[model samples]
Target: MADENGETRRQRNERFEFISPELQVPDGITHVWDWFWQLSGRRHSGPEALTFADVGEWSRLLGIEVLPEEVQMLMAMDDQYLRAVREDQRAARERAQQQ
Candidate 1:
């Protein structure tokens, strides 16, 4: 279902919200998110694709230096999101098998 803003709950939840009091980077999070999607190939690939060299490449491409901590945070979040998606898929398959 969509909200008054016409954005579905899933879309809203999937929206990237960076709320870090520390590690304040002047750049917007969307850049990082987009770069990540491009790097990961829209989640068709795994987090293993997010390597230190790739992070450096992102920094160079963006013309800004990304801190190591920030890259770590992004990788961690990606891993967690992928794990949740896998679990959800597994549950859906089990339910379908049951029916």
Candidate 2:
């Protein structure tokens, strides 16, 4: 059923693709996974596909201030690393669900 905002549960779920896990994400960017999915058009392209401008826009959406150091670090992260992080996070979630 749609809510007051006319958003179905599935629609709301699709808004943030990240499947949160018990594992702690590196860099303490709690929403990094969500931001990653939002910024990238497909999972295959990886985070390297994202640009510094994309990070800036993501930060704006998150309403968080990004320091120059953090921006540099984020921009430097390649798709392989991001994909690994995402895989690890999902695996952890699956493990937790089984327990």
Write model 2 residue lDDT over 1-99, tens digit each, in one string. Answer: 344467644565578684434546666765554455455643344334666767777679779787786665555544555676566558657968999
lDDT of 1 at 1: 30
Residues 1-99 of candidate 1 have per-residue lDDT tens digits of: 343467643665568463424435446576666656565663334334456676677579868767677688778756765675566557657968999
Against the reference, the lDDT scores of all candidates come to 0.61, 0.59
Q: Which candidate leads in lDDT?
A: 1
Clashing pairs in 2: none
Among all windows of 10 consecutive residues in model 2, the one with the lowest summed lDDT is 39-48
Query: What TM-scores do the predictions have?
Result: 0.49, 0.36
- Model 1 poorest 10 in a row by lDDT: 41-50
Which parts of model 1 have CA positions greater than 4 angstroms off?
1-49
> Candidate 1: deviation at residue 95, Å?
2.2
